[model samples]
Target: MSKLEDLKTAVINGKRKDVKTIVPELLESGADPVEMLEQALIPAMSVVGERFKKNEIFVPEMLVSARAMKEAMKIIEPILIEAGVKPEFKALIGTVEGDLHDIGKNLVATMWKGAGFDVVDLGVNVSPAAFVQAIEEHSPHLVGLSALLTTTMPAMRDTVEKIRGAGHDKVKVLIGGAPVTLEFAREIGADGYASDAASAVDAAREILAS
Candidate 1:
């Protein structure tokens, strides 16, 4: 197989050593950094996301793939930046206050990064005021609130309210987690909802487009 295709397979297989080796080789061989990102890295993560959505693979498997992708990106990102490549959208993500569950939140952040968005992860147990403060500081196009427990769902609602109340009219709020539904998202004034990491990419794109 071609080197780029090999790189894609290595990422899908979560072969970090292979990715670490191949990325630099591709760059030294005059491969386009952006092409490596858009073609090999992004598509590999897309496949990983689809597998997760189908239960064909679980979180452990997904994490390895994401780590491999991150390794490849570490090599490619500098080249892209030096070439004046920048992501078109910026996103901030965090788990709501009182919910320390970050597995779901981390997965969504990786997916957003894979899909070419510049993502700032605010970590777990982020407060409504923190979300609003971050939105003010970063001016991101999107914000994601995660709540794993039913109890923390109200915190998600409060966060969305605070973001809107802060008058950041253009920033779209996306909500998701085990207990968060489309109905809950609407009730909380979120612009979009994703059932899982795979769909979060699509939801963010759709919400931004609208």
Candidate 2:
């Protein structure tokens, strides 16, 4: 198989050593950073997300794959930046207020980055006001909210309401988490919901395209 395909497999399998070594080599071999990102990295992460959703891989495996992706990104990002390659869309992502869980949020953020979107990760336990502030500052095309707790689901609703109330209805809102569902997301007025990181990228792309 080709080196790019090998690198893609390494990323999907969470091979950190291979990712660290092969990514730079690919860059040295004149691989386009944007192509590597779109054709390899994003698709690899999409497979990882599918595995996670199917319970074929657990959190630890997903975390390892994400780390590998990040390592590869460290090599490609600067090249993309130097080449004046900018994202097609910008995203603001965070775990909703009162929820400290961030693993899922971080995965989605990294996948979005791999898909060539500018992602601003707001970290864990982000409040409505903070989301609003980020929206004003980043002017993102989409805002992603994550909540892993049943109790904190309400925070997601409140955050969406606050964003809409702030007159930023043009900005699309997305919600996801282990406990979050499409029904719940609809009830909370979210524009979309994804069960995993791969689908999250698809959702983001669709939202921006519309």
- List the RMSD of every prediction in angstroms: 1.5, 2.5
Error of 2 at 63 (Å): 2.2
lDDT tens per residue, model 1, 158-192:
89888889898899999999998999998878999
* Count of backbone clashes, every candidate in sequence: 0, 0
* Overall local distance difference test of candidate 2: 0.88
Stretches off by above 4 angstroms in model 1 are none
In candidate 1, residue 107 scores what lDDT?
A: 85
**How well is each residue in 100-182 modelled by candidate 2, as lDDT tens digits?**
99887987887787666789999999999999999999999999999999999999999999999999989999999988999
Estimated TM-score for each candidate: 0.93, 0.84
lDDT value for model 1: 0.91
The Cα error of candidate 1 at residue 172, in Å, is: 1.0
* Model 1 TM-score, all chains together: 0.93
Candidate 2 segments exceeding 4 Å error? 149-151, 178-181, 195-199
Q: Weakest 10 consecutive residues, lDDT, candidate 1? A: 107-116
